[model samples]
Target: MLNKKAGMIAAVALSTSLLVTACSTQTGTESQASSPSETSKPAKQETLRILSGVVGGKTPEENALFEKEVERLTGIKVTIEKPAADYDKKLYAAIAAGEKYDLIYMGKGNMDVLVEQGALTQLNDKIKASKVLSDPKVIPTKEWDMITYNGGKIYSVFNKSEGGTLPTVRQDWMDKLKLQQPKTLDDFYQTLKAFKEKDPDGNGKDDTYGLSTAGLYDIQGFMSAAGVKYKYVMDANGKRSIPYATDAAVPIYEWFAKLYKEGILDPNFATNDSGKMRELFLTNRVGMVTYWDAWVGLFNNMKKTDDPKFVAKAIPGAVGPDGKVMLRRGDPSVWGIPVNAEHVDTAMKFLEFWQSDKGNILSTLGIEGTDYTVKDGKYSLTPDGISHGMDHGAPFPNNTNFKNPIGTLPGALEGRQIIFDNNATIENSTKDWPNAEKIVTNYAFQAMMGKMPAADAVKKMRDELKAVNLID
Candidate 1:
């Protein structure tokens, strides 16, 4: 029986071996018959993962059209997401956790930290190699320096030369009130008083505030009026002092106290972020505000339906007592690539494409018929296009090769001058920026709400800074 079983097993093994060999021979023959050209496949398209704060709260479907257009133009797929309201914190966690994001849209504050930790890729070599990128016309050397690290290495690039929170008032309001352009801080206050008391909207409703900033901190120009340091106080001798420690800050607190207690400022100043502020202004609740100049066109364009006379213009910053009007320079809308990120080459290519005229047109103007129309060679934004907010990444692009058909929007020029002339550099000099800001913000709120004397607040701020070794 054992001998019979062994003979049967041998026969089965031989059959299996023969079958396997026959299959292999057939496959080999088929493979040999096929030519490289006949079987060649196209390269797999690369996909980039992006994290940006700009598209916050946007539905995937809402973002899909613009993203699809960008993908079609660049031949690279991109996935963008805003994971949290505190974008910087989210980004910090991502970097800490070694998440592989191909592109990161960040601010200088967080960029500094990422650069310090060697989390960002060195982009200088790549930028220089690209045809249109890093061209003096594309982005000036000074602007590039904002993202340059280790003195000369480029780790990031800023999209636009940002003009900061500007004093934008309703042109109709000024005309209706018959008020002159406010040239000084006190003059501005008086204008605010009139705006609150008089119905500039002419609705016969006392529903307007003198000023409606996104936040108290965003009232940056006014904060600097009394020679207060919104950040670092630089003297004629090139000495850096803490703004909170100085007597100049007392008047700033007092002025805000007046605005707050007297109901000249927004009632919801504590809770009103940029979004709420926008609603307040659009609904005819705010007479004046300090916001990004870029919104002048969009806001005016949007409000044209309700109020034809809703002409909003950004005025020169109200001159301060120290013969200065400190405002923020244009935002450094900086973008970066992470070290060892997937599709690095593709990411770089996409960035270069973004700065190109075609890409610029797409991002700046949106889909030709959808976002804008070209009638007789003149490009005008359609209402839907205007509201689309389609800036694939370069919302405020400054490409020399691309002459934007949309030209300069209203209040943009004055905003540029006001910012460039009075660029008050905010202090990020401390090892911990958030801590410094927190210390100042807390004291400022107390002073503004009349919970403490401005002098006492300043003294406390100075003492705190000293205790934390933030000041000498």
Candidate 2:
């Protein structure tokens, strides 16, 4: 009986083995037969895992069109990972864990730290090899220099010719109030005062305020106008100083304190963020505020909602004590694909495709007829185009340090120039702002956080100022 059972089991096992072998052979044969002639078969394409910020402005249909073009150009499938607001945190954690991503869109303050850690690959060699990318006119060498690290190794590239936060006021308000655009410190204050007392919005209610800059060390817009360091201060002798300590920032705070005490500025301005400031402007509570050219939409929309005749316009570039203006020029951050990744070549090719002529046109003008139209050989926005601008904001004036031949939106390009001219006086005026590492080690940011007395904060700032020249 035992011999009979063993023989049965052996028979079953033999049958199972035969079945598996047959399946394997059949699968291999089918695979071989599936291949068509080289002329008829399509080439195999690679896939790139890309992580980008939320792309705005394009509708679902428009985005689909863009995706089709991108697929055709790169010959690679792009998997987009658009995380929520926690994009930076997730990216940081991923990088820390040595997880690989094909591309990453970095932001302002974080890019410096990432570069210092050697997380990014040097792109100078790669850039030089691409003739289409290396043309001097296509990518300005001076701008590319900013993205270089130690020993002139380029790790990243910035997009756009320029960007900044500018102080804009209602031109109609100025005309009604008979006020000149503020050119000096005193004029700035006076203009704000007139706006506060005179109801620039034409509402009989006494609800208007003079200035509406974001507060709590939010110094980009108005504070920069003082020719002081909004983030890092540099003295006449080339010493790095914290603006919180020296006359540069003291005057600004003093002005704020005075405004707060006198009820000329928004009482909550000390705590409000940019969003809140925008809300205030839309509600017609603010006469003048420091904002970006993108706010043109907010102004327009608010006018449409409130009163069509009420116009919100940009304030002329104000003059400083030295007869110069300081504009809050910002930089564009791009996606850098690390060279150590498994798909470096594929990733680079994808970037090249994104910057190509077809890519630029698609990115710059989302969905041709839907977003814009060509009239007399000039690109013009459709009636719905203004909505697209409101949605897309502005493409970085520079794309991967490449010159943007498409140019910027009318208001944005003009506003960017206003910032450049304002800060032009400081071009080479102060040496590079002390590196972030040095600034934090020397200066206690907690004081500026408003936890300590302003006087004590000033003292600590002065002490930290001594390290300004260490870089030189």
Best-fitting candidate, scored by TM-score: 1
Off by over 4 Å in 1: 1-38, 55-58, 232-241, 368-370, 373-383, 389-392, 424-431
Q: Assess each prediction's global lDDT (C-alpha) against the native.
A: 0.69, 0.56
> What is candidate 2's lDDT per residue for 32-129, written digit by digit as tens?
55555322333445666655554433554555555555666655665555555556555555565566676766644445656655677777787888
The TM-scores, one per candidate, come to 0.84, 0.75
Mark the regions of model 2 whose C-alpha exceeds 4 Å error after superposition. 1-42, 54-69, 72-74, 216-221, 224-226, 233-240, 301-310, 316-318, 369-385, 390-396, 399-410, 424-457, 460-472
Clashes of each: 3, 4
Q: In candidate 1, how many Å is residue 175 off?
A: 1.0
What CA RMSD would candidate 1 show?
14.2
In the range 245-291, model 1's lDDT, one tens digit per residue, is 67877887888789889888887776677778877777788888877
RMSD of each: 14.2, 13.6
